[model samples]
Target: MVIAFVISETFSIYSFNGIRIQAETWAEALMKKGHKVIKVNPWDKHNWEEYDIIHIVGPCEFLLQFTSSLVSKNKNIVFSPIIDTIQPKWKYKLVSYWGCSKLRLSCYNHDVRLAMKNIKQIYVRSQYEADYVHICYSVPLSKIEIVPLSYRISPCLHYPQKENFCLHVSILTSERKNVLRLIKAAIKYKFKLILAGSIDSEEKFRPIDQLIKKHNNISYLGKVSEEQLIELYSRAKVFALPSINEGVGMVALEAAVYGCNIVITEIGGPKEYYNNKAYIVNPFDIDDIGKKIELALADDNQQPSLMEYIQNEYSLDTCTKKLITSYNKIVSC
Candidate 1:
């Protein structure tokens, strides 16, 4: 069997990032099953008909044009849309409406519709997304299957000695990520807060800049290499990203594996996976979120042995095997 992966982004540099890791692990797993897998951007001008299977990693319509432009009815094309849903209760209606709009567009688009007409299988990450796809697009439940994205435990050389701060590693731009709200809470609680990853834009950064200057408790460590990020995981006592919405909180899982207590919003897939290991709060309630943080910081039993939990549930080998089983079933059908 020959399997090919088509993604729109540059694969070499950013491939190790969260979603790409699933793609890589799936390809590697398929190889062990005697399938030769090749990963390419669907937007790249490559011969598409040569492989036994062509998998699209996301729903980017641009890639749809590039791939279908070259080949007519590539029999093995598969759609994998990893939906990231993170929204507060009040915002669900608006988000669901937006999703419905996207679904309508997908049904009408020439490339996407053509693929839908020809493709035999669609893969989704969770039951939540699978149900949404069915409700929003009216795609048959039989045509879609649930395959959870498995995360590999990051290699740990040294664990940092944790102090009194909580950590957040998300794109810092969204007002819903609630960084400003977290900052105000930090001032009241006097607990240090460390932020990692890129801020959404410079305009959003301006207010954050003022807050950072005014308070010693909040430190912004801009975009970091993966190693440095893991180092941040090592030192933090608790990890929190009270995003208004999230597809799957990959960072939360990473922090959990490192034994950091979690404080997260009840949104999206993270709500499904938290499993009593976190402090789930209402994303809209800033004061309650702050009090939860304070309570978590003071709790003695907050940090459990998360390394074992992560290894059992989200190891690379386990996820790869599950994905391969789905692929075999899809392709053989």
Candidate 2:
């Protein structure tokens, strides 16, 4: 089967964002399964008829427009909406009333309706996302496939002896990531914190840099390599991801696999994975997040269980097989 893995030109496979990484992983995994996979950029010219299925990863504005065009051509398109957040109706209404770029909103609304009407299959990471796609986008329940993100399970070659600090990893510039709140919580709790990820710009990350300078306990390590990250995960006592929104919070899964105690928000994807095992916190409350971090640090009993569960349930092999099955079903239909 020939699959065109379509994504936005702005989406970098090497970037730390979950969607980009997932797109890369999907392409590689499909190829490994002996399927012909082609990476398609939205702006690039391609023979649309050459592929059996055009699998688009994220529902960004550009990709949405591209999908709409493909729908007009009646191509077999499989969409992974990756809807990170479902805004309330009132929020959309308010934005529309304020005339805050109605063109963008109009495009989004139109494209969502087009996808619901035309796309062959829609894939989502968690039940939360599946519900959001069904309710918010008005997509049929039958068209939605719940396929969780996959992570390669690697044995930790060098597990550090001292597991002392709390770790958070994400792109710092995203407002939805809520990095400032995490910083405040870390400072208030007096917990040693290490943050990893790339900043969009030095100017944009100034506040974070200032906070890092002011606090002795909080440090920004910029971006670490994959090996270094695994080592950090193995050495960290707690992994905190209090993001305002997330598709799956992939870093938390990676940390959990390394036996780090988790304290995550109950917003989107993390809730589906962590459930009752890790300490769940309200992202809006600093005190609650701090308390959860404290609890994670003090109690070390749950790490092994969490790690074992994630390993059993979310391995790359399992998710890849699920995805291939979905692809086959879509094409066969």
Best by lDDT: 2
Which predicted model would earn the best TM-score?
2
* Model 1 misplaced stretches (Cα beyond 4 Å): 9-25, 28-34, 41-50, 62-74, 85-117, 152-161
| Model 2 stretches astray by more than 4 angstroms | 12-17, 41-50, 60-75, 89-105, 152-162
Candidate 2 lDDT over residue span 37-116, tens digit each: 88875467888877888888886666555666777664688888776764774453343233223455555655565545
Q: In model 2, how large is the Cα lDDT of residue 64?
A: 51
lDDT score at residue 184, model 1, on the 0-100 scale: 79
Count of steric clashes across candidates, in order = 6, 0
TM-score per candidate, chains pooled: 0.79, 0.86
- Pick out the ten consecutive residues of candidate 2 with the lowest summed lDDT: 92-101
lDDT of each: 0.70, 0.79
C-alpha root-mean-square deviation, candidate 1:
4.8
Clashes of 2: 0
**Cα distance off (Å), candidate 2, residue 145:** 0.9
